[model samples]
Target: MKKIFENTQIAFALKSNNQLQLSYFLFKVMNSKLLVQLGTKILLLTLKLHLPVQNIIRKTIFSQFCGGVNEEDCLKVVDTLFTKEVSSVLDYAVEGKINEEEFDIAFVKTLKIIEFAKERQAIPFAVFKPTSFGRISLYEKITAKKILRDAEQEEWNRVVNRFDLVCQAAHQKDVPVLIDAEESWMQTAVDSLVLEMMRKYNTEKVIVYNTLQMYRYDRMEYLKKINQEAKQGAFYIGIKLVRGAYMEKENERAEENNYPSPICASKSETDENYNTALQYITENLEFFSLFAGTHNEISTYYLMELMQKKNIVANDFRIWFGQLYGMSDTISFNLAANGYNVAKYIPFGPVKEVIPYLIRRAQENTAVAGQTSRELEMIKKERSRRKQE
Candidate 1:
């Protein structure tokens, strides 16, 4: 494919001069490892002390990385992105809730977003983390096959009910729901639950998407295994393929517990695994619909090449390209400009509630080798282009 991602004009078309400057500043800050570490500590401390810094955060990182404090607050962003032919996936970014009430709230919020997607052409999908619907420890316990006490079994049932309710609503509304992958230790339970949802709701079309963090070494085989299951069960498979977010944590836990790490041994291996999964899914489109959640331009181009070689159309409903809101605008916007299906994962929640998610975004940018630098480079180019204009 041509080097379409280099077109900064189309990429930053929606950003004002001020917004562009803010992006440049944010990436510049993220590019510094020591600054990110110190800033993360200070921000966490501020949040802990309830020090009146919400407004500052809301204006800076929160505004750049998130859509708004709630679903209603995200409509303007949804409409704005839709103007560029890019759709939105309204992700409720709140995390670490450990109670039944909080899980129910997440369930209701997901249902509401699915209904919103049903009504609006701009919002194409809804998303939630597995632990958001339940508890991480509960998922880990189930993954380990420990027998649940009556109370634990009851809690597990509620978790399953939450997943079913959200998937059922999405299916009824004809909206696809993407379930995010979490830590490897708890992911087996999530994968099983998501597969059950697929079997239940995806008999005719894909309505439930399970995310595969391709950084894990075994995901390609897992993908093939699920493909076999989907073939046998006569259901469609919806996948949101991502390189992953929890590498450091996964490696640390594996070392501490004296087990082999699940992550690919190196970034190149992870990249290869991700691209291989992309190729496999594209080749097996009869049973798979892919929502490739990536910011890597080469992987994006490789998928484009696969589509071309296989005679797949750019706008095929079975394929889509996604990037997070406020990151990788070049890939998201340029893909949309080329008539490809593109969606931005617009994370929204209260400023205080989304601090964890924002922190992860910061840490991810810091850890990913060239991600922040690439963002800085693109923003710099866009700014210079505008200055000349």
Candidate 2:
């Protein structure tokens, strides 16, 4: 409400002059739609051809967006952020693995993160994408209510076990785990599985968080339904509310297949839906814990205002503000400086395996109107502020 996010000094407090310049340069590049499109294509091609591009990537965009190559590599970032009263959610950024071995690797990696979170106050949450533990086609099949073959059922059972193991570790460690949302076609099955985890591990408190992509038009109804279920079952619900990440793919697939798009009609409608969900969660804090995840300043302020109106303390345990690491330092750091709970999602993995996630980050900056420019403006302001000092 007081325009707190404008404090560029606090926003860039942890960044060195070099880091600020690097961020500026990166955002300047990201601001060009044509460049981002061409860059992503070239990077993907380079990776596929097994070209020697890792060093170049490691020095540039990878350093800008990712934490490190593994969990231990992320500790420096986790500690540095906590120096500003901001916490870290260690997110394993590897994607597109379809084999049993890879799934097991993700499962084991997640469990390890939970253990790490258990020992560190700086790390608050552990996260995993649902498809990281299983195949997308399998999830799509189950979402469509198609019967699974015996072998597929066995594979699905392993997927469920992976989820349970992570949730159970989180419960034991007193660490909350966030499950990310994927494409619409596969999300129904994921939703059902996450709800089951909530019922199982969230009896005493919110140890599991399901991501709600508020850009989907029908998520309001889903939220209401879950509210009723939580009340009936006497279990708490934890949700990380995001606007969503897969807009172009969602619309294109819907049109190609002759179904209405699940996405909201426009950005304003999506914003309205996100804010509405935020209001609903804030009003029902007794039954819900929220991690407000966004890069949008207005939405961040709206949540702050809601908390003020409700007389909720700034350090309320049931509420948090989050943004991806290497982005939105304005919101994350300034909120932390103001004594609000904040966490940055620190993604780490091998550079090659993590390219897909990095590509999405670049594409997101390109697709979201004005996001890159705003970031560039903030970095420039900080640089100018520092020079005068």
Candidate 3:
């Protein structure tokens, strides 16, 4: 990979104009009303039939968010980013599907990704959502205090087969796997699965990571307990944390279901716990591999500050920074430019299979945060700069 010719990561992290540029891009793409409308239309069509609309989707949302439909397809985009010294995490984004036959297919696809990662020098990590292989409702029932029937047990066995295949592959190939956090109700099941994987595969290298969503009021304590379990089990721990993407959904469901809301009291509270967690993890970096998944400028800067103050080396394998595949390019680009270990979570799947993801991203940006506006501002800035040239 060629060295970045423009602003480096530290420069981009340090500068005001760079922050503005980053904010601009996030707001624009996240806020693009027209693009959202078009995407909605395409998503609806996707439900009716498979439209050979790869080029259109590719140029629009896929270009912004996904890596590619498959490995060979991802090479050019991967190579382009490599030129800027940026790396990628392979994410096969198909979600919300499960059947014995279909689960086997996804299991195979996920294994192929691990194999592909070990074969490539550029790809450093991979992510998997367990729901992609099993029924979330089944997981919910199992996790809740509800007693499982024999049929549910049979179903869970199939799910376990699908999950074990992926984890076993990761163990064989020595690729780190991150299990994404899900809704609060199903999270316990996800956590259980992550623990089982860690117990089996994390004896030497941190082979599996579990995402902790700090927006939940309980996660800080939960992380502490999990860390304790890891120490007791004598296994390495891999933790990747984010502020969380499911706050409103979690709250809405909690209200409907008449359960206590799992969300933090305020955004401030979430941010505080998030920063504190980063500090705590960095201080104990020897015991854990910590990945901070954020687009928050302050959080990124604070981690760098902690690294310096604590005398932690930048080359430490336990530390990494990541943003989504399509969003937060400024953070991703600048961080990689500056030599901090960073990666973009590059998602890939058939267009039809990923509409749910697109819809959620749209809803996420549109909610009161002005996320789309930030993205739009950056795209407009880059476009205007090119125009002036």
Tens-digit lDDT string for candidate 3 (59-167): 6666567777787788777776767677778887877776767777777778888888888767778778878778888889978968889988888888877677777
Model 1 Cα lDDT, one tens digit per residue, 1-389: 68998899999999999999999899889999899999999999998898999999999999999999999999999999999999999999999999999999999999999989999999888898899899899999999999999999999999999999889889888999999998999999999999999999999999999999999999999999999999999999999999999999999999999999999999999999999999999999999999999999999999999999999999999999999999999999999999999999999999999999998999999999999999998999999999999
TM-score of each: 0.99, 0.99, 0.88
Instruction: State, as a TM-score between 0 and 1, how close model 1 is to the true structure.
Output: 0.99
lDDT of 2 by residue, 35-57 (tens): 99999899989988999999999
Each prediction's Cα RMSD? 0.7, 0.8, 4.6
Give the whole-model CA lDDT for all candidates, comma-separated: 0.95, 0.95, 0.76
Model 2 is weakest, by summed lDDT over 10 consecutive residues, at 58-67
